[model samples]
Target: MNERDLKKLKSKKKGKERRAAQKAERARLAAAQLLVNQANAQTDPLSKFPSFINYERNGLTSSLICKKVKELEPELLQWAMNLCKENMRPLYEKSNQGWHEDEKVEEMTEDAAWYLIVLDKAANKPLAFSHFRFDMDYGDEVLYCYELQLEESCRRKGLGRFMMQVLELMAFSNQMQKVVLTVFKHNPDGMNFFKKCRYDIDETSPVDSYEETFDYCILSKMNKMKPTQKTSL
Candidate 1:
């Protein structure tokens, strides 16, 4: 081959080598970035997860749960009891004097169930409450929900909506098919709130004042929530 042709061939080979080196370096950098991203994801699933909280709607549900766990530890019971006692009777009376058991004899109300909702972690008070557990047939297993007690102090501040959302997530995480709750027909504002949440009446009561008849509502969600705290890689 001519000297000129040989020189051209050497130049071409050098260019190809440089191109190959650049391509390999780019691949290495990309792979490194991918590893970093994957590692971060493994450590913090919350970045890709939904923030959810689990809470019971009523105060009585917690009492039952606490009672069952009474043998576990005293600290839990003390904290739970405080939350229940503080919000239990007064809150119930706020709803209606007869809506709940007399505070004095409430301990005897073993039949009453309680649910709890912990408000924002930063809030001065944690959302803890209780409710009765009704066996409403969701066409399959009986559904349970907190019949939230509307408090006089905290009422009308949009807490009901917040509590319901928290309860829904808890129910979903527990494999509950749906959540069922009741509002007195006289509670128009309460009924409106449930309607806004798209709750529908599933059953009506037989009619009594305290345990009175009201349109029962069933609010169903996809049960698709996976709390961020419990998420895994």
Candidate 2:
């Protein structure tokens, strides 16, 4: 080959090597940043809010730890999402949406989102989780439950009711006027569960409509505390 051709070939090789090195470096930095963010999220002081709840069902005792969404380990959050997908597949299929698409990890990181995780203390693994959010609804503070899914083995063990009671306590402590959630009309089990928990059709629920069969039913339970009034003499 001519000297000029050889030199051009070397230049091209060097350019390719440089670009490859830069790409690797960028990937390394991005991975490192992701680790740092996950660490920060997991170490947040969510334990400051109510943490432990203990209960016994059918001769077995269990405990749960409530943590804000920002305080969850990335793996734990992924587990929760997987559980949601497994337990709510019917609802997702009925709604014509992919379960994976409903996994809102980024949105769960918002300040108001929280999770109630039931853990196998010895194994340090999550058995179930409840995801909810505290936010303003029509100028009134409310707690909205997004998902509550338990392992099949954990169901019928009273864990569902226990976690819900804990959620209600958290909402009332935070001064939420009521707790609200939506249930799929086709999910009779879910509807019965919420009804047993004393949740009734919310006042703002939609009236009769042609599309009601495809719509979710909104339910709510008001806090027992009454608002204080000031009187002028």
Candidate 3:
């Protein structure tokens, strides 16, 4: 074949290769989505409660209550608060802290803290076991986190790590550069968990803040992701 003809043939081959790669990637994503749907289908869905579901992780699912939290009255807020208190009381009191459980839920709304609950889908019941709080990280500069707890029964099941991964991705998606958290030095288990996620232990104390015996800092990875033309959801 002439050089031009050969070049045309090579170009066609490259086009085919690119198409094949794209098809393969799409298939991989489809398979992953199918697995998640299958898992959700197998588990019992939550009781269609308002503000009780939303912001679920992939492979995890929730009802649509999160869409209505802003309009939730005192009753819904009370339930969320109690759930947080019941599930997180151990960590709070044992760790030398007890937030205003009732008022805290309202404060989350008033102060921009998102109080989220994650349910265990694979259980006999829809287990409301995971709860967390995080304020928006303005421009990836800083992150303030609170009330991270997993039910004692749900411990050691990889839920904590899964939730953290989801939260960090969400944080980055929301334009956060760094995520920050503070934990009691006495809680070695908590410290170890943060360490596993590559957070640094900053021991600095801020004056006029809630005085704590030991405030080990939880620092996030410095994000260096440049914006791409392709948008991510």
- State which candidate has the highest TM-score: 2
Residue 88 displacement (Å), model 3: 4.5
> Residue 16 in candidate 3 has what lDDT?
90
> What's each prediction's clash count?
24, 0, 3
Off by over 4 Å in 1: 1-50, 53-114, 119-123, 126-139, 150-157, 203-233
lDDT of 2 by residue, 181-200 (tens): 88887788889898888999
By TM-score: ranked, best first:
2, 3, 1
Q: State each model's CA lDDT, in order.
A: 0.45, 0.70, 0.49
Q: Return the number of clashes found in candidate 3.
A: 3
Using lDDT, rank the candidates from best to worst: 2, 3, 1
Q: Indicate the residue-level lDDT of 86 in model 2.
A: 72
Expressed as tens digits, the lDDT of each residue in 100-159 for candidate 1 is: 434533542344333343343334343444342323242222235544544345555556
Pairs clashing in candidate 2? none
lDDT of 2: 0.70
Report the Cα lDDT for residue 112, model 3: 36
For every candidate structure, what is the RMSD over all alpha carbons to the true structure, in angstroms? 19.8, 18.3, 14.1
